[model samples]
Target: MMNHPVSPNAPTASRAIGPTEFRAAMGQFASGLTVVASLDASGNPVGLACQSFSSLSLDPQLVLVCIGKGSTSWPRIARTGRFSVSILAADQQEVCAALGSRGPDKFQTIPWIATAHGTVRIDGALAAIDCRIHDIYEAGDHLVVIGKVLDLATRQDGDPLLFFRSAFAKGLAA
Candidate 1:
């Protein structure tokens, strides 16, 4: 057998990394939980919990969230061209689970109100940001959605809900 040269920073893989391993490895990086929501064609709220959200640009006030192609909410958000991201508070674990779970009307159980922009905002979140869809790009099995921020609100208090190693946690000072 011959050895293959690999970068020191890259994981040693005899074969292609499977989804489980990829997910596990990526989970080492802690991320804040967010609920990306929008109204469907029929004017009903739809949303999903996501960790792949981040600020992209300051000049245009741009942010982005990666939505899986399989997500039911993404289609609605794409059609509506508007969305709101609710950064979950550390106490809102139930809200995270509710929106993340499958085969249920997530909004039916969670407390949310429609914003003036026609997107749903999760109540009692750490912060809520309303945005209009700026652009979208296909990336592997997910779509990277860029948003232009329109309006935002924040509560002065509360820690953010964080995800790491496939579990939820509250941030703490070292």
Candidate 2:
């Protein structure tokens, strides 16, 4: 690698932006929404709307999602050692909102299916990625969960629900 001298005009205050500014800046980049779903000890469903799902390592079939530490649902799902990431379809904003908030009956308001492996999957989602817990790391206000993919399938064909700015968005051009 060739080394180049740092430009004298390089900006140094880029790291000083507040969270609000950072959030607003990040909002310009579109991202797909997903529900991280799992079953509890009694076979009841638990889930949370997660926007941070991404493919990590192709060789080991790994994926990752960052869950907020304040989320009430993640703890229950983490305990199960297995979960499914259901990529929300364009028509599932209600499903996203219901699972995103703190509630005892999130599953009661959403249409979902129970997997044979005991994970919960959203009904009519664009896709489902079932995984086993591989590792976890605490990062500031969130937990970075690494999952080893056991199975995955495309559930339906449609545009995925997206989150931009501070709201849910849909209908991206094909």
Candidate 3:
């Protein structure tokens, strides 16, 4: 094969991006806040606060959540092969903080319910989606988990919680 020089300006060209800069840039894109929860092998509830979640497909009823590789909760949840995604309401900042923290008993202070589908769903959320793990892909420092939605319910009527610029967004203007 003949060697060819690649242009530095090429979109796919390797380049260094500062972690802080990348994070900040990503923060510019607002994302809905959610909690991904499931029952452990011991029948205990466990979960994590997440913003990296989205709907992937309609016909297949698929959803996706990007979980950090370092997340201890994901492994535990993964073992069960099922989980629930609770989309937070705009007033649920405390719920997000509780799950985002490092400790056991996150559910001790937060309100949650056991779904008939064998997943843990947060109470008072805007919506809850129960799913079975469809597939998992290893990406750079994160695992992209694709879930096949088994069932879903709208728990409350309210504005969705949002994250932007590394913090929870204030209420939207009416």
Candidate 4:
């Protein structure tokens, strides 16, 4: 992991990323959009829109998502001990941004319901995986959350939302 800040003394160096280089580099790797959701101890729902979700292993039914260190949703989900991974459909951009915002009211704007484990399960997503936090490790400026899937649900037909070059895209045709 490299720790090169865009500027050493600048307070907002994080915003000064080399966009062209960053986009070009990340564009080479593709990912599906996912909304990582959970309920706080008081049953308040919190979630984040993530493009960094991945399948780590099938044998153990493991999955992982990267959440930034500054994210408000991460801590709440961590406290709850469980979460749900909602694979967004290609048309759910509004839901994505709503959950991706800062502070409270994130759940008020999105449509979801309680999962078997009491975590919030997003409605109309392509799939939803109920998970218990297996491990959370520090990875550069983000936290890599590893989860063991407890329950899984999927729809028969739906196109996934793809994230590439810092924007949303439709999944490729078969």
Top candidate, metric TM-score: 3
lDDT of 3 at 149: 99
The C-alpha stretches of model 2 lying farther than 4 A from their native spots are: 1-4, 7-15
Per-residue accuracy of model 3 over 4-69 as CA lDDT, tens digit each: 998887688557989998999999998899999999989999999999999999998999999999
Kindly list the per-residue Cα lDDT of model 1 for residues 12-95, writing each as its tens digit: 657788999999999999999999998887988899999999999999899999999999778877898899999999989999
Q: Candidate 3 — worst ten consecutive residues by lDDT sum?
A: 6-15
TM-score each candidate.
0.89, 0.90, 0.91, 0.84
In model 4, which residue pairs have backbone atoms overlapping below 3 Å?
none
All candidates in order of TM-score, best leading: 3, 2, 1, 4
Q: What is every candidate's alpha-carbon RMSD to the true fold?
A: 4.9, 2.0, 3.8, 6.7
Residue 164 of model 1 has an lDDT of 87
Clashing pairs in 3: none
At residue 115, what lDDT does model 1 achieve?
93
| Candidate 4 regions with alpha-carbon error over 4 angstroms | 1-20
Please report, as a residue range, the 10-residue window in candidate 2 with the lowest summed lDDT. 164-173
Cα displacement (Å) at residue 77, model 3 = 0.3
Worst 10 residues of 1 by lDDT: 101-110
User: Lowest summed-lDDT stretch of 10 residues in model 4?
Assistant: 8-17
